[model samples]
Structure formats: structure tokens, C-alpha cells
Target chain A: MPPISFALWLLVLVFDTGGQLAFKAASGVPGEGLGHWRAMAVRPWLWLGIAAFTCEFVTWLAFLSVVPLAEGVLLSCLNMAAVMLGGRWLFGERLTARRLLGVALITLGVVLVGAG
Target chain B: MNTRWRFYLVGFLLLMAIDTGAQLCFKLAATHAAPFAADPGWLLRVLREPWVYGAIAGYLGAFVTYMTLLKHAPVGPAFAASHLQVVSVMAASAWLFGERLAPLQLVGAALIVLGILVLARAEDEVAQTTPGHAR
Candidate 1:
């Protein structure tokens, strides 16, 4: 891929990571404070997440506009890697030895999948 | 390869990544934010955030990707590949949000990843055998 395309892919990755984080945050919050509708209208940050998701969808469409379905889907495997990295770095999530091992194996599997 | 398809693929991957990341953030935000105080009020409060908007955008992007993938690839493989989101999201949820998965769930995630990898390899083999131009 060209450098620019690579950058765009990176952008998509970042946005996706952001979106997932937002969902977790929303779901994790306790209690139904203002009901569903009221909460949606009042929270600006929530909208921010929604916007991120919108960007993600648009980017996906843009990707489909060019690449074949199979290739596009295959390339998306990289998202798992991105999440793993993001979870570790941004969230301070524990990478248990077992989980790390799983990640390593998964990485190898992804390589094979990409190469095959 | 056509530059457009290459761009699309990259864009799709980025969106997927952002989607996953945003979910994590939302979870974090939830931890800090007040618990749902009222049904509709809380729901509205959560939905109105810009982050939520971004996630909505990402979902749309994913929808487009899915449609295009279906258009270009066989449904079976496309569906299989799309399911990666499940693994990505769940694993992140467990680690970032402290959501514990049973040992069985962890094993299930591994199985899903393994199955997809195998399928991806099969697709690659088929692609290699085909005589069409890369683009």
C-alpha cells in the first residue's frame, strides 16, 4: 500500500479503538440516571463517541469503494492487534502471562493468515 | 492493486480499530461517570456524548465495509472475517474494564481466532491460484 493509504488505515484503527473504549465506558457506568433518551441528549461526550463511530463507518465505506471484500476483510484482522496494543498502553490493562502468550500465538496466526 | 481498493481496505481497518478503541473509552467514562440515575434521562445523557457519536459513525463505516466485502467476497468468508470484531471487543473489555471472562470464554476466543486464521489461509490459497490481475 502507498504511504497515504497506510496512514488512513492507521486513522481508522485509532478511531475504532476510540469507539470501543467509549462503548465500554458507557456500559460500565452504573444506574440509569436520566433514562435512555434524556441521557443521550444531555451528554456531550457520549455524542463524541457516536461521532467516532460515524467516522469509522464512513472509513469502512471508503475502504470498500476500493478493495475487494476478501482482501478488505483479511486486512481487518490487524484490528485485533491494534486493540491488544491499545488495551495495554492506554487502558493499563493487565496483560497476564497467559493472555500475552495467547496474543503471541494469535499474532503468529495472523501472520500466517496474511501470508497464506 | 487498484489504489482505491487499497485505500478502502486501510480505511476499513482504521475504522474497526477506532470502533474498538471507542468502546473501551466508553467503558472508562462509565466508570468515572455517575451511575444511571433515571431511565430515559440516563440513557439520553450517555447517548449525547461526542464519543457516542463517533461510535455511531464507526458502526456505519463497518456496515459499509460489510456490504462491500459481501459484494466482492463470498458470504461465508466475509462473515467469518467480520466476526473478528467480537474477539477484539471482548478481549479489550476483559482487560481494560476488568471484566472477567470465565476460562471457557477465553478458550472460546482462542478458538474463534484460530478458526478465522485457518479460513483466512484458505482464502489466500485460493487467491494465489487464481490468474486474475491483482487489482
Candidate 2:
């Protein structure tokens, strides 16, 4: 497989994070059942989430087209850390020492796996 | 969606499993198709693979389940739980593709799980204790 490009993975990072935010926002709107979910289908936030997810899919496929599954997934783990940061910054979520250590370990894990 | 912890755990684990299956199918399709840059017909050929369809189906199921999960839980914990897919995929790769993780990779995988666990607990604490959480 060809090497995955930095730009592609970066795009995935952005899209994935954006998708999560959209979904979170969309979930706040009231919906009762499968039918009410149809109502949400038209909501902008949900649409945005779906759109971002669609972009993520395209970018992810492009990345996988070049990189091995293990490597691609290892790199993708960066999203978890990124999302945590985003939550703190955008949502006013607290980041305690434990969470910080968790993020650090995740980054360290990526390095170890990537090196291997 | 704003449900009890036990139900949330079950839903989260189910989503993770489906997500792993979807990714595995994508990998299978990618392995089968010629490189897109090398062959203009690659996308069309890839679409012909049953695994590609399976990937789409699996992804749709995950997406739907995830939308539901979003309501019952906060994004932080939900994402943290969903990321269990990475570990699931690692094991699935070993079982299905005969791939083996290096010792370093194994250690790395452990850290990933540990990190997610720590993050999950923190998120859960935030959700349950924060004001306006409505229990």
C-alpha cells in the first residue's frame, strides 16, 4: 500500500471532530420515536452531522486506499485526543488530571504503535 | 438516551462491535480493489465487491445506533466508548487477517484502552454530577 498522506488524515481529524459536534448538537433537539427521528432528519445540525460524516467516509476511504488497516487505525486514534480538547475548548467541559493523563497515554500509545 | 447506566453500556458496546465489523469490511474491500491512483476503474470495481456493500450496511447500522446513543449519553463518554472499536478491530485483524501486533504495538494497544478508560470515567463523572444534568 502507498503511504497515507498527512493532509488526508488531517482532513479526517477535522471532519470526524466536526461530525461529533454536530451529532451532539442534534441530539439535544427533542425527538420521541423513529418517526420523530424523521423530523430530526431535516434538522440542520443532524444534516450537518450526516454531511460531515459523509466527508469523513470519503476521506477515510482515501486514507485506507493507501495505508494498512493497523496503521490507519492507529493514526485515527488521534481523533479521541482531539475531541477531548475540543470538548474542553468549545463545550466548557472540565479536563481533570486523570483525563489529561489519559490523553497523554493515548498519544504515547500512538507513537509506540506507529513506530512498531 | 438519558437512560440508565447499564442500558447505556450495552448500547455502546453494541455500537462498537458493529463499527469494528464495518471497518473490517472496508479493509477487505480495499485489499481486493486495485489502487485508485493506479487504476481509474478502481472505485467502480470496489463497488462491485460484496464487502463494500457490507461496509455500507454496517456503517448505516452503526450510525443509526450512534444517533440514538447520543441522546442517552454525553458526547465525551459516547465517543470514548465507541473508540473501543479500535481494540475490537485489532483483535479482529488478528483473527480474520492473520495480522499480529508487535510487542510495542501490543503495549500501545493497552495504553489506548487505558486512556479510554480513564477518559470514560472522567466523562461519566462530569455527566452525572454536573448541574442541569437532570440525572
Candidate 3:
């Protein structure tokens, strides 16, 4: 891979992982229905998530501009793993054997589609 | 089903719907502005396309639905579940665009569904053991 493509891929991964973790943090607020939405609206984490996602979109578009869409899709599958690790590290979410097996299987499935 | 499972089912379905809608909108936008070029005219055409706005709306709708689901659903499985759109988009393309579905892709789609079922069972187990756990 070229340097520019590699850089764009890295950017895509970072932005996507950051965006998701931020959203998870933001969504941890308490309440229900409209009240929950209102509470999250007043917080900064939600905006942070949105901003990261916007950046991710731009970076991802750039990545796909250089890389083939198939390879891009395959690479993007790593974001799921990245987010899962982030959830475990930052949020203390459980990562049982069953969950790991499930994620691994899904990642393989996506890889097959991308490679096919 | 209990209220918790009902919430998961409804929320995930809505998310998948929004995601499929967004992909379709983007496909329409691209088709409308075909023969891609690196020029102002092509950019202008994409900007002028109504489907582009629909795509943006779909993105917003998906974002809201995802965040709502994240309130209770774990990010890992929720994200995996979110990719169900891949299967939906493939099916849509097959039906609407007359695209051919490779056998490998079909196998892959099946694997993805199986993975989600396992993850769902994991979540159910966790929920049963710890009543107040969000996932």
C-alpha cells in the first residue's frame, strides 16, 4: 500500500473507534425516552461523537478514493474489534468466550464477502 | 417476549431499516451522477442530486437510532448487529438492480446471521444473571 492510502486507513480507524467510544460514553446517561434524549443533547460527549463521525466520514471517503472498495470494507471490519476492545478497556464491558467467538465469526463473514 | 427483548428487536430493526435506506439513497445518488470525474461539474451534479440529501437524512436517522440502542446494547454486539445492513443491501441490489449474488457472498451472509444469534444468546444470558446490567 502507498503511504497516503495507509495514512487514510489509519485515520479512518482512529476516527471510527473514537466516534463510537464517544457515543457510548454519551449514551451512558440516565433517563428514558424524550428525557434521555434531552439529557444527552445537553452533554458534550454526543457532540464529540458526531464530530468524530464527521471526521471519520471524510477520512473514510478519502481512504476509499485511493483503495478499492473491497479492501476498504475488509479493513473497516477491524473497527468492530477496535471498538470492542475499547469498550472492555474504557467501559469495563465483559468479553466472555461466547462474545469473542461471535465477533470472530462475523468478522470472518465480512472478510469473505469483501474478498469474494 | 419480555419488554427488554422487545426493545432490542424493535431498536435493531429500526437501525437496520435506516441503514438500508441510507445505502439505497447513496446508490441512487451515485447512479444519478455516474461516469465519475475529478471536476467541478461532477461535484456539482452530486451536490444537486436530491438523493444526496436523502442520504444525509438517512445518516442522521441511523445515528439517532444507533445512539438510542447504545443506551442499553453493548457497543460491540450492537455494532456487529448494525452490519446486518450488508445482507439487506445485497438483497436489495439483487432484487432492484438485478445484480447477481455470488455463492460465496450468500455463505458469508449466513455466517453473519449465525454470529448475531450467538451474540444475542450471550446477551440474554448476561441479562438473566445480572438483572440491572445494561447489556
Top of the candidates by TM-score: 3
RMSD of each: 19.5, 4.3, 1.7
Better of 1 and 2 by TM-score: 2
Q: Which candidate order results from sorting by lDDT in descending order?
A: 3, 2, 1
C-alpha DockQ for predicted model 3: 0.72
> In candidate 3 chain B, what residue range of length 10 has the lowest lDDT sum?
B126-135
i-RMS for every candidate: 14.7, 2.7, 1.0
For residue B61, give model 2's deviation from the true position in Å: 1.0
TM-score of 1: 0.43
Q: Which has the greatest DockQ?
A: 3
Looking at model 3, what is the TM-score of chain A? 0.95
| Better by TM-score, candidate 3 or 1 | 3
lDDT of 1 by residue, A7-106 (tens): 6666677777666555433433333434643554465545666788789888877776666654655576666556656545644443444444444455
Worst 10 residues of 1 chain A by lDDT: A24-33
After TM-score superposition, what is the CA distance of residue A108 in candidate 1 from its true location, in Å? 20
- C-alpha lDDT (0 to 100) for residue B117 of candidate 1: 56
lDDT of 2 by residue, A11-116 (tens): 8999999999888778777867786587788789899988998999999999877777768877887787777777667665577777677677766776666667
